[model samples]
Target: MSHAAALTLPFDTDTILEGLKSWAACESPTFDAAAVNRMMDIAGRELALLGANIDRIPGRLGLGDCVRARFPHPSGETTAGILILAHLDTVHPIGTLEKLPIRVEGPLCYGPGICDMKGGTYIAVEAIRQLLRAKVATPLPITVLLTCDEEIGSPSTRDLIEAEAARARYVLVPEPARPDGGVVTGRYAIARFNLRATGKPSHAGSRLGEGRSAIREICRQTLAIEEMTTEDCTFSVGVIHGGQWVNCVATHCDAEALSMAKRQEDLDAGVAKMLGLRATGNDVSLEVKRGVTRPVWEPDAGVMALYDKARYIANAIGFDIAHQSSGGGSDGNFTGAMGVPTLDGLGVSGAKMHTLEEHIEIASLVPRARLIAGLLTTLGA
Candidate 1:
C-alpha cells in the first residue's frame, strides 16, 4: 500500500471516539482483577471480529489475565513478526468514570486512562483494521498482547512480554506520545522500594521520652532519600502510611518509594545510597525492601533503523517526528533492554496522565493510527 493511501484511510472519527469511550468506561484498574478481566474480554472479542486468533491467558498472583491476538501473515511466512505491546489496566480505581467521564471538548477527549494508554490501545486496533480493509498483504505476522498489570510496574506480564518480543523482529509500544509530539527511543532504569520503620509506642502525654517515634524515623529517612537526587538519578517517596493519634507516639511507619536513572551506573549508586540510610534513633529499626528493578532501555542501531522507517512515514504524512528518553517504564523497556528492536510512544498526544484530568488530542487519532498502519505495511513489505 502506498504511504499516501495509508494516511488517507476513511477513519471515522465518531466511530473511533465511541470505541475509546466504551473501553475507557469499563474502568480496568490494575488491582481489580474482575474489572480488568472484563476489559480483556471486550478487547478479545473485538480482535476476534477482526479475524485474529484469540488466546485468553489466565491471570496469576491477584492480577487479571492477559489477552493475546495473532494475525498470521497472508503468505504463511511466520518465522518473524511485529509485536504490538500494550496494557489495558489503568491507575484510576473503580468509580472514576463518574467523576472523569469521557467527554470531548473541542480537539481533546477527556477521561480516565484515555491519554495514558486506552487511547493507544484503540489506535493499535484501528491501525490493523484499516490495514485489512486496504487489502494490503504483509509477509510478517502481527501479534497484539494487552496485559493486565502495567500500571503497577507490569510485575506479572514482564516475562510474557519478553518471551513474545524475543520471537518477534520488532516491538511497538503504543504508549501516549510525548507532550511535544516526540516518540520514545530510550527509557530510564527504574526501581521500586518500600521502606518501613518500627519503634516503641507510648502515650505522648504520659511517656514522651520513654517512647521512640517511628514517624520521626520515617521522616528522617524520607528527607535523606529525597536528598539523594542528582542530575541523572531521581527519587521520590510516593506513598506513606503511619501514625495512630496525636496523643500517642507511633510504633510503625511505611513508605513506598521509587527511583529513576538514565544510566545503569547512576541507578546502582542511587540504590546504594537509599539502602544505606541509617536510623536516626537507636531504638528505631529500618527495613528496606526492593520491588521491581527495570533496566534502562538504551538506544541502539536497531532503534535508529526503526526510527528511519518511522520518520519516512511521518514525512509521507506531512509531519515531523522526534524521539526522546522517558523516565517512565513500559514493556518496551524490557524488550529493548533484551536487545530486541523496540519503538515506543506511538499513541495519541495528550497530558495529565494518571490524573482525573487526563485526556488526548482528538485531531491526532487518525494521523497517529495511520502512522502505525504505515509502519506495519512498510515492515511487512
Candidate 2:
C-alpha cells in the first residue's frame, strides 16, 4: 500500500484499547522498580513482535529499567530519525486498580495511568504496527524509548533520554495532549529541593520547654515556602515526614518541595531563595538541598518549524491542533533545551491526571494514532 493510502486506513480501536488496558493493569508506579520493570517487559514484548531491535537497559539508583526499540527502514539506511518518547511509570500506586478499575463509560475510558501516558504510548506503538502491516515505508527509521522514571522528575533516565534524543532528528513525547487537542512546543523550568529541620527532643509530657519541636519548625517552613509563590515563580511542598511518637518531641523533619517558572532566570532566582531559607529559631537548624532540575524550553525557530509540521499533519488528519507553552516538564524539556526540534503532549486527550479520576477519551484513540503515523511517514522525508 502507498504511504498516503496507508495513512488513510483506520486503526482498530478495540485492539488498541486491549493493549492499553494490559499496560494500565500492570500498575507500574515510579517508586516500585519491580512493578515498572513488569510494565517495561510488556512494552518490550510488543516492540519485539514488530521486528524491532530491542535493548533493555537495567535500572539504576533503585529505579526500573528502560526499553529502546528501533524499527528498521526498508532501504537499510541507518541515520538519526524520529524518537517516540514515552514513560512506562505512572504516578498511581500498585493497588490503585482496585480504586480506579479500567472501564469504559460514555466517551471516556477510565483507569490508572490511562490519561497520564500509557494510552498515548500504546497508541504510538499501534500506529507503527498498522503501518508495518500495511507495508508502508517511512522516510526514516523510528525509535521508541520507554523509560521508568518520568513521574518523579526522571531522576534515573534523564541521561539516557538525552543520549537517545541527541541521535534523533526530532523528538515526540506522548505525555497526554493539551485540553484542546493541542501539542506542546515549550515547557516551563522546574526545580526540586529537599528540606530538613532539626530540633532538640524532649518528653512531651514533662520538660517540654527544653525541646524545640522540629514538626513546628517544618510547618512554619512549609507555609513560608508556599507563600513564596509569585507571578514569575511558584513553590509547593509535596512530601513531608516527621515524628515517631506522640509522647516525645520530634527531632527531625524532612520535606520535598518543587518550584516552577516560565524562564530559566526566574527559576534560578527561586532556587537561590529556597537555598537561602533560614530557621525561625536559633535552637533549631534548617538545611536545604537541591535535587533534579528540568530547564526551561522556549520554542526556538527550529522548534516552531517542527510545530508547523505537526500542525499541518493534524490539519490533514481532519483536526486542528494549537500550540502552547505548558507548565509541567517532560523529557522534551531536556531535548528542547538542547536546541532539538521537540514536540510534546502528543498523547491521548483527557483530564484528571495524577489522580484516581484519570481517564482518556475513547474517541481520541484512533485519530491521535493516525496523527502520529502521519508524522512517522512524513518526517525526515
Candidate 3:
C-alpha cells in the first residue's frame, strides 16, 4: 500500500467533524479582533496539546493576533521545512450561526465559515495530531502559521507570511479546495480602488440648476467603471455610499471597486486607467485611490513539481485532484509570487463559499487529511 493509504486509516471522519464544528462555531469575522483572537486561542490550545512550541504574535492595525506553532523533529533538524499556512477569519458576521447552524445532513455538513476555510484549517491541525499519535517522524520539522486577516487582503500579516515562507522549503495553503476537488497552482492578480466624487450642494426647492449633484456624478462614474471590464481585465464596483437627504443635492459620494487580471502588466494598466478617471461635468471632481492588491502567481517548474507529488499521493489514496489557476485571492499569492514552491486549495471540497449556504462534503474529510499527512511525511524525505 502507498504511504498515503496507510495514513488514511488513522483519520476518523466523525472525530474530524466534531473538531471542525468547534472552529466554525467561533465565527471569527475579519474585522472583529476579539472574535478572531478567540478562534486563535482555540487553535493555540490544540497545538499546545500536541506539544508544539507556540509563538503568539500580537496583532497590528486593529487586527487579531497570529499563531505560529513549530513541531519538534526527531532528528533535531532545524533547517527549512514545510510551512502550512491558514487563516481563521471569515467574511460572515458574528451571529451567522443562528441562521446557518453547524449540522450534518446526509453527506454534506453546513455552517458559517465551514467551507471557506475553517474546515481546512482544522484538518491541518488534525493531520499533525494524527502524525504525532502514530509516532511518525518526518524528514523535516513542520511549522503552521494561522493568520487573522486574509479575508480583508491580509494587510497586517503579509510580511509575516513572506518571512515564514522565505525560510521554509515548501508552503501549503488550505484555502477552500476548487469546486471540482482540484488544487490551485496559480492565481490572478487583483487590485482594489477607492473612489470619491465631490460636487457643489444646492437646495432642491429652487436652485436645482445651480448644483452639480455628487450622487448623480458617482452613478455615472459607476457605470463607466464597470464598463471597463474586458476579457483581459475585469472591474466591479461593490460598495457605494452617497446622499443623506431628499431635499438637498448631495455634495459628496464614495465608492469602492475591485479589478482582477491574469497578468501583472494588465492589472497595472487597469489601475492607471482607473486613477486617470476625470469628471465629465464642470466644477465636479472625481478621484480614484488604489487600495490593497495581490500579485499574480504563475506556476513555475518548482510549483509544478510539488503539484505532481500531491497528485501522486491523491491517486494512491483512491482519488484524483486536478489543478487550475483560480480567481479568488489568498495568502498563497504572496508566497507563490515570491518564487516559493507553494500548493494551495488543498482544503475540504465544497460549494457556496462566502454565502449562508456554505458547507463541505462529509466524505472529503478523511481523504483530504490523508493527502495532507502523506505530504508531511514524504515531502523532502
The residue-by-residue lDDT of candidate 1 on 112-229, one tens digit each, is 9998899998988999998788777655789999999988888898889998998889999999998888799999999989899999999899899889999888888888888888
- Regions more than 4 Å wrong, model 2: 1-3, 74-78
Q: Quote the lDDT for 347 in model 2.
A: 92
Cα RMSD (angstroms) for every candidate in the order listed: 1.6, 1.4, 1.9
Candidate 2 vs candidate 3: the TM-score winner is: 2
Q: TM-scores for all candidates?
A: 0.96, 0.98, 0.95
Worst 10 residues of 2 by lDDT: 1-10
Give the local distance difference test score of model 2. Answer: 0.91
Q: How well is each residue in 1-381 modelled by candidate 2, as lDDT tens digits? A: 122644576698888888888888899999999999999999999999999999999999999999999888764525888899999898899899999999998989999999889999999999999888877888888999999999899999999999998888899888899999999999999999999999999999987888999999999999999999999999999999999999899999999999999999999999999999999999999999999999999999998988888788777778899999999889899999998899999999999999989999988999899988888888877
Q: Candidate 1 — which residues are off by over 4 angstroms?
A: 1-5, 75-78, 244-248
lDDT of every model, 2 decimals: 0.89, 0.91, 0.91
Q: Which stretches of candidate 3 lie over 4 Å from their true place?
A: 1-8, 75-77, 204-210
- lDDT score, candidate 1: 0.89
